[model samples]
Target chain A: MKMAIAKQEVRALSGDEAVAYAVKQSDVDVVAAYPITPQTIIVERFSEYVHNGEVDTEFICVESEHSALTACLAASATGVRTFTASGSAGLALMHEILYVTSGCRAPVVMAIVNRALSAPINIHCDHADSMVERDAGWIQIYVENSQETYDSVIQAFRIAEDPDILLPTMVMLDAFVISHTLESVKVLPDDIVRKFVGTRQIPLVKNHEGKLVPFKLDPENPVTMGPLDLYDYYFEHKRQQEDAMQRASQKIKQIHDEYGEITGRRYGNGLINPYRLEDAEIAAICLGSTAGTAKTVVDQLRAKGVKAGLLRLRAYRPFPAQDVTKVLENVKAIAVMDRSHSFGAYGGPVFHEVRHTLYDAATHPQIVNYVYGLGGRDMPQTLIHEIYKELQKILETKRVKKPVRFIGVRE
Target chain B: MTAKQKGWKELPIAGLCWKPSTEYFTGDWRTFKPMLDEEKCTKCLICYIDCPDVAVKWKPEDEKIEFDYNFCKGCGICANVCPSEAIKMVLE
Candidate 1:
């Protein structure tokens, strides 16, 4: 007999609400967080669940985002499922321990409601928050909407807790674009979610007595965690983290497919969600909720006999470079959209990665970068259409006259 | 051997301080050692309570204290806190 898939319960929820519900169902043992815009709703909703006796979780409202991550790190080290949520400033505050959490191989899952970093202090959607931590060694999955946010949160636990890929994972949803917007999301049933996420699978480590014990903060096993190492072993520890990250890309796809098998929903291979790229000459790449708008534009352009396509990047870190190269090989010209800038770099972070990934491709497509939607600025479908128009121009000219351009904003 | 030379798997999980800390033997850093004067000691046990290193060992039966010189860094905080002037820091 075939294994029967769990029935998904359809409920209308905001991105933050969906994430909190997923965390509740995952049997998370600890949630420590400090509130910030967009992400505040996630922790706030989870706290209500804890207060109403809906979940038996230790909800720690930490004083700072740093302490929040530290608390989650300590709890996760004890081999329990742990979670936290934060946005721009909050994520920046947790920067130091972000590496510490992943470096210690603590599978602490975080929902980063992507928001712009501040100097003028704006609370809005942007990839700047998670993008800044791109090199921090955590597995990153950017979701397009509330449904994907909820589903990714559940899958994140499985991927992070896998023994071969015990690194922290960040499930990113755009701030106001997804986090604050309500949509109908199909959530897995409570028992089904519990069974699917399962229990934490901690590996065994040797104790001082040479006896094997579960690797955690166990009294019987007594293993020191996060010890200071100057140069003697620091490099080797970092190398170990990178090795785990390299292993994570495949692990993410496996877990994503496993979840899809259960719920009947999956992003394209759990990394790159390509739309209308099969016979397209011009394509635009983006992430988060903007992909939804871009997909609409792709359909609109297609009706007019324009071979326009969109590649919605679902996973940013441990970038699916080979997969991206393979998918974009036949395209003539491509436009990479970035919600965040890289200061003085060649282009935005995502654009740079896509360009580099295609550098060794058998067929090179003229790629251009558009740094748009900074500081929660609106990305109208017209602007995305203009991006495609620029790609069309590049295709006709066979060259990128302006390699990097800003969209919609007056200079 | 330093951890840099080890393979990723060979390195201890999470850079855990696996070996007992006693193996490091921090006592060699001591420049001064505390000398106990039994007659001057009031049995206040101030030295016992104030020591950060747990270097001061108490003998409850005899109502006196002893120093474990092996682990003590000999910071002389005990001598400063002693009201009875029982623990006098002497140059090693």
Candidate 2:
């Protein structure tokens, strides 16, 4: 079911540059962001676009990440497209407003260059920053490379702004790995991207005056947003957020397939991308750039008659529980690799979710957790090979002696 | 008759406050209510300007001042701000 790609040009761009270029062509109305490592280039390049008269986006340089997200939330409340980027401490600083943005249904799209959280003050790549905010009600998408970064950034706006799923979204790229490394990205023409994104469709809501008006902060038809809700209605609002998240699983896939038809590029049904897993006896599940390396390992294992496969999770927030269950139900054993660890929890975030997702399946695979590459540590091909080997051994032993293992770390 | 409360599905997508704040009757929580002494009251309208809840009502055409006890939290700001000591805080 492959479709022909329309007119496109191949450009060598890093992950950050790809996000900026996609946002520039998407015709975002406003961008408010504070600069941080790995993600700084995105706003910096977009500001250049603003200066060169390439795009008429309102580029706002805020004092801090908190104010940056606050400004974007306010701008988005006015019913216009808005974007921002952050990583590491900057993402952490914008933590409080993340909940506010999604709770208010602002539909603001952000690019998070995945970086290790501080204390050690490392600026390298890891999922800890965004992974910690997993419950903040944001749609999270992790990309494998610069090309996916570019494609996903364009798709994020449509997914977040869908009328049925007006939730904020975060497009993640590994810091320094994809953010600094350049790759050949096929970009659709500006007009095509513009046409594909179209305009945000705001739903009509009844204001206090009993008149139906667009759900935005308009002087002509005023409405209060992010109002204080006590016990009387707070639970209902939280339930509505959960319902929108449930609906987002389907809406994201629909939007992904629609975009694929126009560009001939699609990632595994827009939720989890399965690689060589059709007849695989053993598989490894991971998120972000590590999947690219793991795929090479799987190919090498296949060459040696190993029935190994990889399932790269693209969307983490929605969890894609049913799809994951259907895909891995028959596999003999699985290794879930997480770049971020949940302190005092049973395992890493992805491992816990995947195991929970498979709890009721007809066939239970011997699953293990591997916390790897914290603080921007490199996950080489050998480590991925080690994981597959461990899975192979677990399949034979019929038991997991250790449910969790720290990869590439000295005892 | 009271309007029926909305279910989660029928309510606005987010917890958007579309109804005016006047919809909630906060005065029920008030233990002390403000009482005005019209005899000693000047036409200064100090209570009307000092009330935080906008519960003090003053009509320019009628040249009259009244209290909207429905929303008043009885903070006693009006009684404290009355220059002529024309307002008193009475237990509800």
Q: Assess every candidate by TM-score.
A: 0.85, 0.91
Error in Å for residue A67 of model 1: 1.0
lDDT of 2 at B3: 53
- Contacts from the true interface found in each model, as a fraction, amount to 0.62, 0.74
The sequence of per-residue lDDT tens digits that candidate 1 reaches over residues B1-92 is: 11225566776667766466665456767899999999998888888899999989999987889998887898999999999888888999
Error of 1 at A37 (Å): 1.3
**Candidate 2 per-residue lDDT over residues A220-330, each given as its tens digit:** 988888877876688999999999899999998998999999888899999999999999999999999999999999999999999999999999988899999998877
Q: TM-score winner among the candidates?
A: 2
Q: Which segments of candidate 2 are over 4 A away from where they belong? A: A1-4, B1-3, B28-51, B54-69, B74-92
Candidate 1 regions exceeding 4 Å error are B1-5, B18-92
**Model 2, TM vs. native:** 0.91
Candidate 2 lDDT by residue in tens digits, B36-84: 8988888698888888899999988878788888888889999998899
Candidate 2 local distance difference test against the native:
0.92
Q: Which consecutive 10 residues in model 2 chain A have the weakest lDDT in total? A: A1-10
